[model samples]
Structure formats: structure tokens, C-alpha cells
Target: MSRYVLERVQLSAQNHPKRHAAVSCAIGGLLVAATSALSVIQRSETVSWPAVIAVAVIGGGAWAAAMAVFVVRLQRRMKPLPPETDPARVRAARRLMRNGELGPDPETNALAVRMAEQLQSIPRWKKFTTTAFLCTTILGVLVTAPAISDGEVGKSVFYGACTLFPLLMLTVGRARLDRHHRNAAEIRRAAEHRTNTEAER
Candidate 1:
């Protein structure tokens, strides 16, 4: 059952390749735009439109190239499922990809709980790095706060927003992960209770 679930998860990537690619590209573009804007904000008062355009072009090109490589590698790695495979399960897997939630199937929910548990066991170095990144972003927000008092409202707001973006994303992601874990755990417990009751009969 676990193997079946994993295979379906893999095949989900193949279900809407173009849609996935487009979303990824859009995210990359936004990141590049943010970086370019940050660069401009950190520059001299005499803004050079040509320089800003150059920065945007370079950032966009780099992001595009990296995304292309990623897509190629992902394509090469994904193996297509057999045509005779269950369409309902395939659709469920794709739905899971879209929203990080499993179906009501007890066994699938058990697997998801296990996967979530594994994800929670972060390495020491990774934990350290994550803490460091959060600290750096917080520091950025603090450093820019003084600019607001100095009457540079626009610069301060932009910098603060840029710094806060990562923190906001991390908070939202963590909340979602916790919700999924709790749901999976509940499903697993219910399945166990049912099995125990059946055994007593």
C-alpha cells in the first residue's frame, strides 16, 4: 500500500506537468523581481533605470536557466505509470499534490502520518541553518525600522516587506504541516480502534 501511494505521488507530477511548470516559473519570476527591487533599494539616490533593467534581465535569465535544468532533471526522473492503472487513485494523488491532504483511506493516512513524522526529524545542521535564516530576516526588519523614523518611509516599508515575506511563508507552511499531521494522526487512531473492535468479535 505504501509503495502504491509513493508511486501515485510520483505519477502526480506527470499529471499536470505544464501547470506545475507554469506555477514554478511564476514563482521564480516573482523572486527575481523581488531581488531586483532589493538591489535598487540598496543603491544610490540617483537611480539608473538602465542599471535596474540590466539587473532584472540578468536575474530573470538566471532564474529561467535554473528552472529549465530543474524541469529537465525532474522529467528524466519521473517514470510514467501503466495505462491500466486506476484512474481514481491517480486523480486522488493529483489532488493530494494540489492540497497537501490525504484521502479518508486509513492505510494511506497511516503512511502520511509516518511521512510527516520523518519530516519532523530534522538534522541538527538544518535546524541551525533555519534558525540562523529566521534571525537574519528579523534583523533585516529591525535594521530597516529606523529608516521610517528618519522619514524614508518608502525604503523602510519595502525592505521590511521583503524581509517579512520569508518569515510569513515559513509560518504558513509550518501551520499547514501541523494541520496535515494532526489529521493523519487522527485517521490512524480511528483505524486502529476499528481493527481492535473487529478483533474482539
Candidate 2:
């Protein structure tokens, strides 16, 4: 039973890369929104707090709503287990999936488990990086606000970098993940084709 469930988990992880990232994106979006709101509070003397909060709420809510739509679409697009797949495995997979534990586990093959662990760690690492980024951004803004009053151009440039670097890093990371998934898909297709040709021969 566990074996079958693990197999299904592995299948989903390999086939549904986009779905795995959905929750992560939601987390990041919320984090960014919170930080932006905090930044507003920090600059309340210079900025209109009520107006900034209104914009943040509207923008963040819209972004979150859009992401929710994307997640629903991705879920619908996920391919079900093939007709030839074992009924018991399918049932177990569906149960575990409903509970949201569809990643590889200790019972899975060691090599595959290691790979899954590595992939799973990425989100954890991202969470840590997001926290660090938030702290850095906040600190930069605080430092720069004081310097801006003193007319320090160097501090202003650093503040701009602090704001943009985290976003740039996230974009690059997402691009890399997309490329990795594309390559994985190509390899899977080629392997399937080769196996089918050999079986026909």
C-alpha cells in the first residue's frame, strides 16, 4: 500500500511540476504584500498610510485572486493515472493526494527519495531566503530613509538595489526551475518513445 502510494507521489511530482510551485508562489506573494505594507508603515510620515494600504490591499487581493485561478487551472490540467495503472495504487494515491502528502517518502527508493528531498528543500530554502530578504529590505529602507534626509546618494543607490535584488533573484530562480522541468519533460518523452519502439520490435 505504501509502495503504491509512493509510486503515485513520484509520478505526480515528475509530471506536475507547475502544481508543486503554486503554493510556494502564494506564500511569496503574501510575504511580499506584508513587507510592502510594513514598508508603508515605516514611511508613514512621508506617505499617506490609508491610501497606501488601500492600494496594497487592492493589488495584493487581485494578485492572490489571479494566483488562485492559476492553481485551479493547473489542478484541472493534471493528468490522471493511466487506465493501465493499478486500481489499488490509484485509490491510495487519490487518498494521499487529498491529504496533500504527495511527495516522495522514506519508503520510496533511496535515490529517488534523495532527489525528492533535494527538490523539497528548495521551498524551505526559499522561505529562509524570503525572510532574509525581508529583513535586508527593511533594514536598507530604514538606513536609507535617514540618509536620504542627509542627501546621501550612495545610500540611495544601495536602497534601490535592496528593493530590486530580491525580485530579480526570485525571477531567475523561477526561470531555472521552468527550464529544468522542460528538460525533464523532453527526456521523459524520448525515453517513452524508445521503450515503445523496442517493445514493437
- Write the residue-wise lDDT of candidate 2 on 34-142 in tens digits: 7567656655557776877776776666676677665555444444334345535445433433333333432222222233233333323556776777776677677
CA-lDDT, candidates in order: 0.60, 0.54
RMSD of 2: 11.1
Tell me each candidate's TM-score: 0.52, 0.42
Please report, as a residue range, the 10-residue window in candidate 1 with the lowest summed lDDT.
115-124
Can you tell me which runs of candidate 2 are displaced by over 4 Å?
1-29, 46-49, 80-171
- Candidate 1, position 177, lDDT: 59
lDDT at residue 176 of model 2 (Cα atoms): 65
